[model samples]
Target: MINDNVFNGTFQNLSQKNMPFEQVFLNILQFMEKDPTGNFKLMFGTDSQVYSRETKFITGIVIQQERKGVWACFRKVILPRKMENLHERISYETTLTEEVVSLFTEDKKEQLIQIVLPNIYKGASLTIEGHIDIGSGERNKTRIFVKEMISRMNSIGLKAKIKPDSFVASCYANRFTK
Candidate 1:
C-alpha cells in the first residue's frame, strides 16, 4: 500500500505553511475559480542533489494561469545514502514526481478541468505537464536519459517537457535541492 504520510506531507510556498495535500488542492481550485477565463497549466517536476552523505530530492507542483500568476509548492525527500549514479538519480527524481502526480486522482483532475471548460470558447484551457530535469544538449551529462524519462511521464498522460523549458524542475525545484 502507498504511504499516505509521505504523499500527504506538508507542502509550503512563500505564503503558505505546512499545508496538507488537500489544502494545496483547494488552493489550486480557488486560484482557478478566481479567473476561469485564463489559460491554466498544472505542472509537476522534480530535481535532486547528491550531498556527501545523502541525496536530496525536491518535487514541485505548480498551477499557472498564463500571463497572470502562479500558485506553487514543493515537498522534499531525502535518501539515507548518496545516489552517485547519473541514470539512477535521474530515474529516482522522475519516480518522486510521478508519486506526487498520482495523488491528483482522475476526479481531482476533472474538477480542475471543469473549471476552465466553460471558458474554452474564450481560448481558456488547462493542460498538465511533467517536467524532467534532463536535456538533450551535447554537453549535458543527462542527455542520454531524456527519451526514457519523457516516456515515463507520457505513460501517465502528462505532456512531457525537458530542461530549458522545464523551469519547474531545472529552476524551481532545483533551488531547494541545493
Candidate 2:
C-alpha cells in the first residue's frame, strides 16, 4: 500500500493494466520463484515531463533476473500545475522513487531474499537500486544535483545509479513521461 494513491493505486505493464501494488509485489515474487537460482536486481526510478498546465511523473519498478528475464511496471502521478524549478523537480522525482522503495518492507525484502538465499553459495543474490536521471558530466545540467539525490538514496540504504547506468529513470520511466 505504499504511496498507493500516487499512481491512483494502479500500475500498468505490457500485459496488465490497473494492477494494484499488492498484485505487482506478488508478480515480482512469482517471477523470482520461477528462477530462484538466478541473480536479481530490484530497481526503482522516476522521470517527469511538464506540460503547459501540469506535470506528469512516471515511476518504474523493475525486477530483473540477470540475463534471464524481467518483470516491470510503472505508476504515474500528475500535478495540477507545471513544475519549472529544476531542483524541485529532481527532488520530487527522487521522493517518488523513495516511496516506491518503501513498499518493500523488511518482511517483503526477506521474502525476496529467501528466494535466492539457498543458492547464495553458488552466486544467486538480490541488489536493490535507486536510479537517478542525472549525470556527473560537466555539460549535464542535472549534474549539480547528482550528489544530493544519490545521498538521499543512500540514506535509505539503496545503492544509487545515475546517467548512462540509470536506465530505469533515463530510459524506462522516461518512455511514459512523454
Candidate 3:
C-alpha cells in the first residue's frame, strides 16, 4: 500500500531492450541511479519475445519502510528535467542484506513483468501492487524468508562488482557540477 499513488510514473530503461543479462543489469543499474542505502528494493524482469527475437527488461523499485506496520512503496521515476537538486546528498551505504538480493529472484523477476511492469507503464506512476501479509506474525516467517533468500542467492551468483563500482564512483562524482 505504499507508493501506489505514484507508481505509474516509473518505466523500464529503453537502452536495455533485447540485451543480455549482463548488459541489462548494467543498464538498469544506471537507469535506477538509486541512493545506496536502506531506501529501496529493486525488482526487474527480462521477458522474451519470440516474434522479434528479443528480450525486454523492465525494472521497478519499491521503497523500504521502517514503520510499525509493514509497508512498501513503488517510487515514480523522476524525469531528469524535473530534478531540482541533482547534487542533493543521497545515501552512500552499500551494505546489502540477504533479503535485499533475494528480491532479485527468478519468480520476483517474472512477477515484475507480468504484474508490476504494465502498471508502471500505463500511467507514469510508481505503484506497489501487493499487501503486507503478516497474519502469522514475524516469528517463523522471517526465518523462512531468510532461508529462501539464501537459496536464491546460491542459485544466482550475485555479488558487487569492484571494477564497475569504482568507475561509476569516479564518473558520477562530478555529474551534478553543472
Candidate 4:
C-alpha cells in the first residue's frame, strides 16, 4: 500500500521511470482539465499472476479520450508466497483490487466525478470498468467465483469485467506479472 491507508504505489511508462501516485493522479486531473473536447472515460483494474515462490499483482488506471488519445498508469506488488489453489489466488487478486480502490479517498472520487460528469451530458461518455482475470470455461475452475467477484465490486458501486472485456487485467496487467 502507498501508506497505511493511501495507495501511494508508483508506476512506470515507456519513456519514464517510476512515478509516485500523487504525481500520476495529478497528471490525470490535468489531462481532464486540459481536455477541450471533454470526451473521456476513466477505468481501473487489477490483475495477478503466480510463480513458484511469489505472486505478482498489477493495478492500472486508464483514461480514454476518443479521437484524441489514451493514457494509462500502473503499479505492481509481489507477495512472497503463492496461495494454495486457484480459488485462493482469485480471492487474493480481488483483495489487491480492493486495496487499490480504497486508496482513492472520498475526496478524490468526488473530484473525479465532478470533472468527468459534465462530459456525459455534453455527448461524451464515462465508464469505470473493473477487470478481473477469471474466465468461464469448461476447464476454468475460477468460473464458480465470477458471480461473487462481480457482487463484491457491485457492493462498492463499480461494474466488473472479465476475460475478453477485461483487457486491463487479462492483457495489460498480465504483461508486467512476468
lDDT of each: 0.91, 0.92, 0.27, 0.74
Model 2: per-residue Cα lDDT over 48-167, one tens digit each: 999999899999999999999899999999887799999999999999899888888999999999999999888899999999999999899999998899999999989999999999
Compared with the true structure, what per-residue lDDT tens digits does model 4 show for residues 26-119? 7777887776346766666777777888777787777777778777878877777775687777876777777667767888877877776777
Model 1 scores worst on lDDT over the 10 consecutive residues at 1-10
Per-residue lDDT of model 3, residues 8-45, tens digit only:
43322223223333443444344333322222233211
Q: How many backbone clashes does candidate 2 have?
A: 0
**Cα lDDT for residue 139, model 3?**
50
lDDT of 1 by residue, 26-48 (tens): 99999999999899999999999
RMSD of each: 1.9, 1.9, 19.9, 3.0
Ranking by lDDT: 2, 1, 4, 3
Q: After superposition, how far is residue 159 of candidate 4 from its true place, in Å?
A: 1.2
lDDT of 4: 0.74
**Best lDDT among the predictions, by candidate number:** 2
lDDT-better candidate, 1 vs 3? 1
lDDT of 3: 0.27
